[model samples]
Every structure is written in structure tokens, then in C-alpha cells.
Target: MPELLDPRNDFLFKRIFGSEENRDVLLTFLNRTFMEANKPLLSEIILLNPYTDKDSPTDKQSIMDVRARTTEGELINVEMQLFNRYDMEKRTLFYWSKLYTSQLVEAQSYSTLQRCVTINIVNFKLLKNEQYHNVFHLREDRTGIELTDDIEIHFLELPKLDAGSISLQQGGLANWLLFLQGATPDQWEVLTMNEPKLKKAMTTLEFLSQDREARMRYEARQKFLHDQASLMEAAKNAEIYGFKSGVEEGVKQGIEQGIEQGIEQGIQQGREEEKKQTALRLLRLGLAVSAIAEATGLSEEDVHSLSQSLE
Candidate 1:
């Protein structure tokens, strides 16, 4: 028996939880996520884009998310993201906007827009907080008052789950996330007992894992994910390196030119402090406003402002 497939692989996820055949799995998972968050549990859900054989990873164009609609007309999108897309927040907003706006075709009232909820089950960490689950909504920044319930987004950061702490305290959400995180055999038994449909979900993974062609596609998908993560990390490192180099070069050039012009205090007293010290000294030296601006890398307006006081 081959090892069970990981549910976090979006393709495998769609296989187990995105099809009408496994609508129970998707319902339980969504219910657990909402229940744990103290949000309303969905009595029933309809998959707007149910899965089919063409969803296999062999087809590069397969949709990666499980889109559904609650019985109450609320739009829900559940996506399994195995990499930290740095733009997750903005990406979520874009989708939420699309779903919310797509509700009204033409001449429809603004009140016709149904609530759009985007639930992202992400493998890597994105939020700074320790909680594995974070829900966001438009609210007053300081007063903490929600302006509307029209747009809701959930970010389930898998990395933030503390393995030691989640015995059963949070219940179904923890179990489902653990299943996605790859539960051990013993843990799998406990989880299945906790959620009846989970056993079927596990069975789906087992069946997929043993099939030769399915195994091949899963492997290919895993390789693609690994390559994608590597590319994102490399790009992030390059961006950071470029930023530091630019800052160092700019500061070094300004300091070198200041020192060469015989300004005694080229020692940076921090950026703003350094600017003030250099500007004051150049001002005291009776240099022209333009000359001081050139020496300190400040605009003429800035030099004039610095020349006024605090010398």
C-alpha cells in the first residue's frame, strides 16, 4: 500500500473535497472552520464548480480552489495554497471583489450583493499573530466596530498550529487542518472518529495513492509546488538584497562626497539626524542654500527648513 496522498495538494484536495460525490467532506470541513471561529455553521452547501476527471494535475489549467455557495446565497471560496504568496491579502481582496460584484448583472440594487467569504488554507505562515485561524472584515480601525458583514475572509495559517496544544480543544478545525497537514496513522484514527466523513476523505486519499497514474500526477504536482516555492524564495531574497545594496550605496556616496568637501562630521547620526547635522554645519559655514542642498542631499526647500531653527 502506497503512503496516503496529502490533502493539501490542491488537486488531491479537489479530488477529496471538491466533488459532488464528496460534498459531505467539503461541508464538514467548512462547518468545522466556521464553527471553530464561532461563525455560523452551514447547514448545507452547493459546489458551484464541482470536480471532474479533467481536474487532474495533468491538465495545467485545472482550477485549484473549491468554490461553493451556501443555501443562503453567501458565496464561499476555499483554496489550498501550499506556498506563501506574498500578495495573499491583495489576491484575496481581488477575488472577494469579483465574487461580490458578480452577484449583480445589470440594474441590480447594491443591496443585492451577497456576502463573499474567501477561505484560504495556506501551508506557510502569512499573518504575524500566533492563532492558526484569522478572520477579517471591514471595520472601524480604532473602535473595532464592523461596518458590514458583506465581505469576510478567513486565513488558516497551518504553520501557526501548535502541535502540542491542539489535542481536541478546538475540535473539527484542528482535525481537518491536521488531516491537511498529514496526520500520523494513529492520529488519523482519532480524527476519523471525531468527524465521520473524514474516514471517507481518508479513504479517497488511500485510493488515489495506490493508483499508478494518480500517483504519477501527484508526484508531478509536488515537484511543481517545490519549484514554485523555490522561485518565490529566490525572488524575495533578490529583492531584499537589491534594496540593501541601493540604500548602502546611496548613503555611502552622500557621506563620501560630504567628507571630500572637508565637512568634519561625516559620521552618520542616523539618516534624519545626519541630514540635520550636515545641513546645520553647511549653514553655519555660510555656504549658499544650493551648495548646502548639494552637500547634504536635501532639496533646497529642506535645507531652507533646516536652516530656520534647531541648529
Candidate 2:
């Protein structure tokens, strides 16, 4: 048996955008996303917390929650959504609103607000539009003026992101997506280029996917996703389980009830702190920023800053 594949592990997803050694790869990927060929890349990254345990926690599954940020003082939230729970839209709105508003404390002024990017990785399609990646932001209708480029939301649909075509090999998103979907070892050689960082990440991910224990966890998650997809399909066919309109109606009520009681219900805040400290410690041990970032939730920028502070 091979090593189990666990997508919820930050140590596993480190290939995506965590690690100083792979910083160049991350910068390259983000640069491509920015639409400017040579623009400066993000200096830091605040990785999304995968676990719900906030304080001192054990390494476990990978289910990157709704948010993380960049070291350049930018907030980046990456969410891995496996099901189309009825309140996904509203839930997203609520989380985003919380993140956006949480920037300032009671005594802090609004000027201290930071830029935020919310990236959602969903199994379901968010819109009926043609694009796989949809970005939303506030903009002036008439002049096309962005009231603030500070807050942005990026949605990536796994089902819609096709990789069989030749055109996609041009940049980082394709490469990263393939990596995320657990590309085959045979496909690894096909990803030819002198890009050492990306190659390293791909190699690392491939190696981990071979672990039997990891593969078991990954298979379990895959099965869960399959089950959810089937449920949605059955409901679409007017099946009994899908006819629960009352459940949908009660979702908002339940969420409201939870919120009314001041229950945030996730360890995002605590996880962020833990990841930050872990990143700093790893950096002190002379580990690569990308690796450290992936292992912890700190961004390359944050790690670099912490690394410098220690000097």
C-alpha cells in the first residue's frame, strides 16, 4: 500500500504556496494571476488554517477553512468546499464580512484596514458563467473605478478546471491545480521546465501521495465528496432527501441562532496564531520558508519578517 493522500494536511498542500524555497514558484504563480508579466510578487502569505482547533493542536486532516493572508499585509482566504450546503453563499458572505470587519479593533481607526483576498476552492459551480475562476469586488458601475482593490474574492471550481488541453500549460494556475488534484507520477515528467521550485513542490506532493496512510485519508475524503455529489444528483431528480425545503429554510435560522449567541464556531483565530509561531520556529531552525509556511499557517513574508527579527 502507498502513503495515504490527505488533502487537508497543510504539510501536504505546502506545495501550493508555502515555503521559502518555493517562494519563487509561489511568486511566479501569483504574478501570473495578477495579469502583469513582471509585476512584483507578494512578499508574504498568511496561509488558510485547515483545522478547527485553534490553540495548541495536533497535525491532522486538511480542510483549509475560509481564510488566510499574505505577508505584505494582505489577507488571503482559501476555502476547500466539498459540498453544496444550502447556505454556502450566505455562509461565504458572513465569513467574508467577518474577516473584512475584524481588521479594526474597538479603538483602532478605519485607516488601518488591510487588503483581503478570499479564494474559494469549490466542487460545485458558483455561477452559470463560462469562466472557471471568478473574481468579485466592489467597483463603480459607470467609470469602472474600483472603490477599493483592497478586498477581492477568487473562486476556483475544480470540476470546471480542465487540464487535458495543451493551452493551460502556460502558467502556474494549471500546474498548481494539477498538483492539487493529485497528478500522477507519469504526469510529473510531462511537466517539463527549468522551474526548480515548482518541480520540487510537485515532487514533494507526489512523494507524499505515495504514503499509504495519507492515501487512506485522501480516499476517505474523496468518498465523502462522491457521496455528497450523489446526494445532490439524487435530490435534483426529485428524490426524497432532496425535498427537504424545511431543512434549507431552517439553516438560516440555525445560523442566526448560533451568531446571536456569539458563537464563531471555528478555530481560525487560534490556528492562525499557532501557524504563525510554528512558521517562526521553523524559520529559526533554518527550514525553507515554503516548507515552513506549509507546515505552519504563516506566509513567506511573515516568516521572512520573523526570520529577520531574530537576526
Candidate 3:
């Protein structure tokens, strides 16, 4: 069955902010989170690349990209982090610095640099001391003086939040965060006291979550995420296998590909290579041509040729 509320599920995430309309909805929600005055706020907030190392050729390097800037001149970068890589903190700082620096052109002064906010939705805890959802702003360490208002960082640890304890009136953003992290088939009735816009937001989320098309979209996203994770794992495995006195994994991948071609030549080559490799002990065990052919999805003659070649 398709999952209803997994952020890793692409469909659900897209349903949240994938399209222009949905993005509009989310932008509105984010604005409300700030308690911004009811004026025309953010006009356009575009999603850019989310991964830290954009230039890296490795498939494992690229991650889900989600960054945007508001119309009223506020920048927001949101990332959905699954694993706690050692460099996450550093990478976030680097991105923030890069974004901050990119604002100033050859002639523009640093004073013109607008305020930017980054929200990281990490599945794992980030800071060691602060356990709850935390927001960081620049301030003087000794005298508690405000350094600058141009930057803000908010970190939400999904596993650390509890929806029941959060108040609808006092904790608006907190409620929203809880809703996002809440389990599937959540009791919507308990959340009726939220702000009007948040009520609308929940309605939207509920409608999208229940829709069949939305379900399919979420399934497709899950598949994509799964494929990406698999690719990264495969690359890591390849690198590891390359390092150790072992080419067995590489040879195994190649032979598996060959065997999938159901043709005589392909099967013969696959079996011959497999049989000779001491690493593949199962292949070394003698078996009838028909038996080998059946097991590997190769024809009997092809298996016989492979057996002969191996001898």
C-alpha cells in the first residue's frame, strides 16, 4: 500500500509544494508562520538544487533540491535530510555563506543584502545541547547584543516533536511542524482550533492525501527516492569492493546483466565467466546443462558451451 504522509515519498512532498498552486499555498503558510502583516508578501519563491555538492558527478552526491526566495525580499532554503552525514552542519553553513555572498554583485554594497532564512527538516538531531526545535539568530556572545538581522536558521527535528503538547494559539509554527511530522490518518478534529489559514492548509493536505492521483504521485516519488538511495548504496559498495582485494561485486553485476539478455551468446559468456571465478562457489558446483540453463535462465546449449569454456 502507498504511504500517506512520508516526506521521503516524492508524491506527498510534491503535493505539499511541487506545483505553482501548492507552492502558493505553502508560501502563504510560511508567511503566517512569521506572523507577517496582511500585505502582498512573497511573490515568487523558486525551488533550486537541494544537494550540497551540485557539481559532483556521482549520483550519490545529488539530493532533493528545495530552495526559494519570497517576493517581499526574504530567502528560504528548506532541506529534507534523512541521514546525518558528518558534513551536514558545515555544508549548511557553506550554502548559507554562498547564498549570502551571491547577493552582492561587483558594485552592490553589503548593506543591500536582504534577510535570508534556512529551515532544515532533519530526520536526525543536529545540535547536541538543544533537543527541541531551535532557531538560531546572530547575537553577541558576551553582552547579548544583536549583530545583524540578515540571517536566521531554523532546525526542526521530526522525531523530537510531540503534537499533543503543542498549543494551537501560542505555537502556530510548532503546530504546523507537528502536523507535518504527525502520523498518517491523524485526528484532524483535534487541530480545528488552528488559525483560519492553517485550517485551510490542513484541508488542502487532507484532500491531497486522500485523492487517488495523489496516492499514485506519492508512490512514484517513493520509488524515485528508493532508486536514488539504491544507486548511492551501489556506488558506495562499488567503491568499497574496488578498494578491497575483491572485484567479485563488479564481475557479479556484469554477469547478472549478461544473463538478463536471454540470448545464447550472452548466456554462454555469463556462465563461463561465473564458472571460472573461485569467488562464485555456487557456479563452480557441477550441474547438468539443463539444470544450469534453468537456474540462470539460459538455454541448455548455451550452458553446455559455458561449461566447456570453463573446463
Candidate 4:
């Protein structure tokens, strides 16, 4: 038997549930996902960025996420992320803000903005909890009062899903998550027997996996994504190492300069100058202002001022 393609590949993911013909499959999956999270079920959705098969193999620059608008005008964006970038929290909030604000024209009021939901299917674990499915909302800390139902984010950690314990008969969202994680042929057979929508999804996956052109495109996209992930990891490592080196140098310089100056005021000035220099170096390295401030022991406001001056 031929090996099945990983449905978590964003390209294949889009082809599976981002097309007009597969709207029902997407609808069922969304409803099940929301219900599992204890949210209202979606009755209807209109795909904003419908999937289209590429004529040639392309890089990962192509946007393959599915964007939809519900019957109530709530926006939903779903994307399969294969790598953990360590910035998903901030990235999700940024994208959610854009989606929520993009609904209105110039004269529209804030009341016209609708809720925006982001569903990220990550191949790696994100939360510290043992649960595979994690949901977020804007709620008060002490009283647990929701500020509004406008912001919703769900993370489905594929690695956290227990394949052995997942039952097709009972696992509503688990069935879909397992399928996306590339269930074996035997598993697919069993899953299809229990979930009708999943059967349709499996058919689409098999069809796309077997197509010569589609396979090439998928391979190309996968390669591009891997390359991007590798680059990001390298950059993160470099930033960490550089920060450590800077801190060490700053401490060494502070001690040496203080000893050489041999006066209370001189020592204070020396340490201050060293810290400022370290902060400047970190800023030049493109570290975030908060990170630079934390590393250099400078106030966030000072770091921001330094960053602006450098720019």
C-alpha cells in the first residue's frame, strides 16, 4: 500500500477543506471543534480564500490558510503550522486584530467590528497542560468575567493527541486531528467507517496525494517550509548566544572599569556606560525592546528610546 501524505502540510490541508466543494467537510470539522471547546456550533460558513491547485511547484510564500466568514459575520482563520516558531502567541493576536479590524470601512464605528477566531493546528505542543486542545478568550483574572466574546483562539496540538487512545466512535475532534496527523491506511479505514465527513476528507487527500503535479507542489511547499523553519531556528540560537556574550562582556567591562577608575562615582558611571553599550548592541541585533531591556537591566522605556535613536 502506498503511504499517505501528511494532511498537516498546509498545501494539502487547504486542498482538503479550503475548496468550495469540500465546504461541508470544513463545516463539520469546525462545528465539532467548537463543540468540543464548549462553544456555539457554526451553522454556515463562506470561505474567503478558497483553495486553488497551483499549476507549478512554488515556495512557502503562498498563503494556504483557510479564511471564512460565518452567517453572523464572525471571521475565522484556520492554518496548519508544522513548526513551533516560539512567537505563535503574539503572532495569533496580531493576525486576530487585523482580521477583526478589517471588517469595517473608514466611517464605521467600533461596534461594527465582529468576533475573530483563529484555529491553529500545530504539529508540536504549545501549552504546558496535558490536554491536546487548548482554547483562549478574553476574561478577567479574578472574577473570570469575559470582557467580550470577540476574541477566540484555539490550538490543537497534534503531538499531544494520543493516537492509541483515540476512538473514532467517540472522539469527535480527535478523529479529525488524527486524520490531519496522517493516519495509517488501516486507521483511515476505521475512521472512515465511523465519521462520514472524515471519509470525504480522506478521499480528497488520497486524490491529491496521487496526482503527479499536486505531489510535486506539495513536496516543494514542504521543502520551503522546512528551510524557513531552519533559518528561524538558527536566528533564534544566534540571538540567544549573542545576548549571553553581551551580558558577559558587560559584566567584565563593568568590573574592570570600576577597578581602574577606583572611585564610587567613577564606578557607577562605568557600569552605567557598559550597560548602555550592551543595550545598544542588542538593539542593533534586532532583539525586541522588552527582551533587550530584560537582558541589559534597562527600563523598557529606555530601551525603546535607544531603539528609536538607533533607527
The C-alpha TM-scores of every prediction are 0.78, 0.58, 0.56, 0.79
* Candidate 3 structure quality by residue, lDDT tens digits, 71-144: 65667776666655546778888878877888789998878888887767777677875455667789999997
Would you give me the overall lDDT of model 4? Answer: 0.87
**Quick one: best lDDT, which candidate?**
4
Residues 50-166 of candidate 2: C-alpha lDDT, one tens digit per residue:
332231212233333434466667776666676675566677777777788888889999888888766676666777885767777889999988899777777776677678663
Candidate 3 scores a C-alpha RMSD against the true structure in Å of 19.1
Candidates in order have lDDT scores of 0.84, 0.61, 0.61, 0.87
Cα lDDT tens digits, model 4, 1-311, are 35667888888889899999999999999998999988999889999989865423354343778899999999999988998888989988888888888998999898998999999999998999989999999999999999999999999999998878876777589989888887877787777666778989998888887888788888998887888899999999999999999999999999999877778777788898899999999888888988988898889998888888886
Deviating ranges (above 4 Å) for candidate 4: 54-62, 258-311
Cα RMSD of predicted structure 2: 32.6
RMSD of 4: 17.9
State the weakest 10-residue window (summed lDDT) of model 1. Answer: 261-270
Candidate 3 has a TM-score of 0.56
Predicted model with the maximum TM-score: 4
Per-model RMSD to reference? 11.3, 32.6, 19.1, 17.9
Would you give me the overall lDDT of model 1? 0.84
Residue-level lDDT tens digits of model 1 in 218-287? 8888888788789889999999999999999999999898777654443333676888788998898899
Task: Find the number of clashing residue pairs for candidate 2.
Answer: 29
